[model samples]
Every structure is written in structure tokens, then in C-alpha cells.
Target: MTADTAKNFGPAFKTNWWARAGWLAGFLYAAYAANYLDVSWARFLQGLGNGAAFLAEMVPPNFSRWELLAANLIETVEIAIIASAFGILFSLPVGLLAARNLMPSWITWPFRAFIALCRSFHPVIFAILFVKAVGFGPLAGILTLIFASIGFIGKLFTEAIEEISLKPLEALRAAGAPFMSVIIYAVLPQVLNRFIGFSSYQLDANLRNSTMVGIVGAGGIGGTLFAAFQRFDYDFLAAILISIIALVMLSEFISTRIKRVFQ
Candidate 1:
């Protein structure tokens, strides 16, 4: 509207040649990959035909073996809850230590690196490693989800801590309050609600991952689902899929409620 405002705003769009070149490179690479992979229209149509036949086999779910399904579902829920509890406990101190605004460089560096290491691998990869290390059982799944939760929750917690107002902390220190006292009084009050929200979200994620880890013999409903696939029991597979969907939806409902209550 005004000359000064127009001058400050400059042009509506600013061209960055480097960003343009990067996008062009990405598009070129995608095209090259598609060509190399032989992704043709004919093959896509043929795959769709095959998928239609596969869906025909899955038409009425079989819940005849409800006992086994229930047991595995219970195990999956247990693994998620246990992993979430342990992950929350372990991440609390690690996250605090990794907050650069709150801790020294020497302390933050190691903790931050540890969090990065936890995040570097996918939960499936961690599950496979733990399966080999701990033998085939729920222990492996628990460990995988725990590390996954720590990576996610710890990183977010550190960021939240960093963004907190430092005035309360400064006042506490000036008043000769103990370090733990200062943290308990100042740092936590600002981030507790956010931490609860993060914990609930991580729990939901863990529930889904718990089912997947069982595919590698980590112990849950995924093992049953994999068996159904291997046996060509599409009806049973359909039942398991429905069950997993229900589990995820239920977890989502609970997570939303928790966030609302805390808010």
C-alpha cells in the first residue's frame, strides 16, 4: 500500500537459481528411475488385473481361530504399553541432557549423538537385529519399539525444552536454588503437557510397530498375519487386517482423548 511497505516487500516472488536447479535435478532423477525400473502403463494395468483376482480370495474374513488371534492381539498391546513406559522413563533424562540450552556442550553432544543413533535405523531393522540378539520373542519387539520411542520422544522433548522461557531458570539460579530444584520448578512446568502429548503419540506408534515386529519372529499378531499370507489363507489374512485396523483406530481414539484431557 505504501512506498516503504512496497520497498520492504520487494517482488512477491524471489527466484533462487540453486533451489530451481535442485528441483530440476530431483525431477530428472525420478524420471531416470522410472525409466530404469521399466514402469510402463501396460505392466501397471496387468498388475491391477492380478490384484483384482487376489481381492476375490479375501472376500469373507475367517475368524474361526479367534482364540489365537485374541492372544496375539493381547501380546501386541502388551508390547506397546511396556515399550512406551520404558521409553518414557529412559528418554526423560537423556532428553534433558541433550537440550543444549539447558546443558553443557560436553553433556549435550553425547546425548544428542545417542538420540541420533537411536533414530538412524527403522524399527523393522532394529527388530531384526534384536531378534538375532535376543532370540525370537516379544523381547525383541519391545526393544525395537523402545528405541524408536526414545528417538522420537527424546528429539521432540529436547526441542521443547530449548524453546522454553529461560527467565524462570535464571531467577531460580540467582536465588541459589539447586540445579534439580530449578529444573523441577521451572523447566518441567513449561513442557509437561507437551511431553504427555508426545508420550501418547509414541504409544500409538509403538502399537502399530509392535504388530510389524512379529513378522520377524519378535512375537505378536504380525507372525499370524505372515503365516496366513504364506499359507495362502486370504480369508484369514482379511480378518487379521480388519483386526489391525481396529487396533489402530482404537489407539487413535484414546490418544486424542489423552491430549484433550491434558490440554
Candidate 2:
């Protein structure tokens, strides 16, 4: 091979042994896990057959109890709205406080830790705890989702703040603007679009999650859906799934419009 060609292909800049080894290790681990878990083609085929049978049962969706279904769906939307509203509101300050670029470590650390703590638990667990505390209803679901939103929204907002350019901030400070003024003029302008996007996305997520929290009796459509499942009311369950699909699509349309307006 020519000298230049050899140089071009040399391991000095091209080698990434660590990465290759990591990939190999991951592949091996996945194979071992599958074997350990008894993941066989026969088992998979059996599962598929079972799933097909289930799907057959769910066909011909029944909305005979449309009144009850409608009430639960509305309650789910209400939970999502209330949770998203309060969560997004609270997340703003939490995000601001956690921004390492703007706040000192002492100030940022506690807030960051708190957000971390909020994120550590899954929404179902939070729903369970709140349900126990409040003794069932939409309030428990609302509280659960609020904490979930703060965790997700707070982290994203903190990251958005950290990614903002420091130039405007420096200029505003040089111009002797107060702390709040600096944030108002220099910070908000940059991240407002992203913040709105995050909030709307969280609202969308809360809507889906609200439906699930109800399974635990925290409120929404989940309890009804679960009961239907137990009673082998697969037709009704199918209707609920279709309604949820509609709800999500509606949210998606709204989110697109809101994003377009901001853009």
C-alpha cells in the first residue's frame, strides 16, 4: 500500500478498541439474558397465538355505556390539565434555580437534587402513594402527575437554561440591569419557545398517564378499563382504547398548532 493510503487507514486515529469491546460485551450480555429468560422461538409463537386470540375478542368495539365512558374520559382530561397547569407553573422556578450557569452551585445543587428525587420514582408509584394519602379520586391522580411533570419539565428547563448563550446575559449585566431584568430580557427570549414546547408535550404525556393512574383508583378511565378487563368486557375495552387514540390525536393536533404559533 502507498504511504499516504497506509497513513489514512492507520489505527492511530481510527482505532476505538474500547467502543468495539463495549459493543461485543453488550451483544454477549443480550444473548446471555435471552437464554436466561428462556426466550425461545416456540414460546414467542405461542405468545403470538395468545395475543391473536385476545385481539379477536376485542374486535367490534362497544360504546353501549357511552355515558360512563364519556364521564371517565372527561375526568382524565381534567386531571391532565390540572396536573400540567400546576406542574408547569412550579417547574419554571425549579428549573431557574437549578441552572448551574445562572445560579451558584449552592443554589443549584439543592434544586437539581430535588428534581432528581422527583424523577427517581415512576408515576405509578407516585399515584399509589397519593391515592393512599388522599383515599382515591382525581385529586390523587392530579397530585401524582404534578410531581411527574415537575420532574420531567424541571429537568428539561434546566437544560434549556444551561444551553442558552451567555453573551446577552453579560451585556445585560454590563448595562447594570437588575437580576430579574437580565432574566426577563436576555434569558426568556432565547428559551421561551422551547419552554412552551416542553410544557405542551408534558400536557400531552399527562393525558395518557392520567388514563393509567385510574387503574389504581386514583381517578380517570383506568379503573373502568381495568374492571372491564376483569369482566372479559373486551369489546368495551376496545372502545376505550379507540377513544384514547382519539384523545391523543386531538392533543397532537393542538400541540402542532401551538408550536406553529410560537415558531
Best by TM-score: 1
Candidate 1, superposed: residue stretches over 4 Å from native: 1-29
- Local distance difference test values of all predictions, in order: 0.94, 0.95
Name the regions of candidate 2 deviating beyond 4 angstroms.
1-28
| True-vs-predicted CA distance for residue 183, candidate 1, Å | 0.9
Residue pairs in clash, model 1: none
Cα lDDT tens digits for candidate 1, 1-263: 68888799986788999999999999999889989999878999999998998899999888999999999999999999999999999999989999999999999999999999999999999999999999999999999999999999999999999999999999999999999999999999999889998999999999999989999999899999999999999999999999999999999998899888889
Clashes of 2: 1
lDDT tens digits by residue: candidate 2, 1-263: 68888778775577789999999999999989999999988999999999999999999999999999999999999999999999999999999999999999999999999999889999999999999999899999999999999999999999999999999999999999999999999998999889999998999999989999998999999999999999999999999999999998999899889889888
Task: Give each model a TM-score.
Answer: 0.90, 0.87
The TM-score obtained by model 2 is 0.87
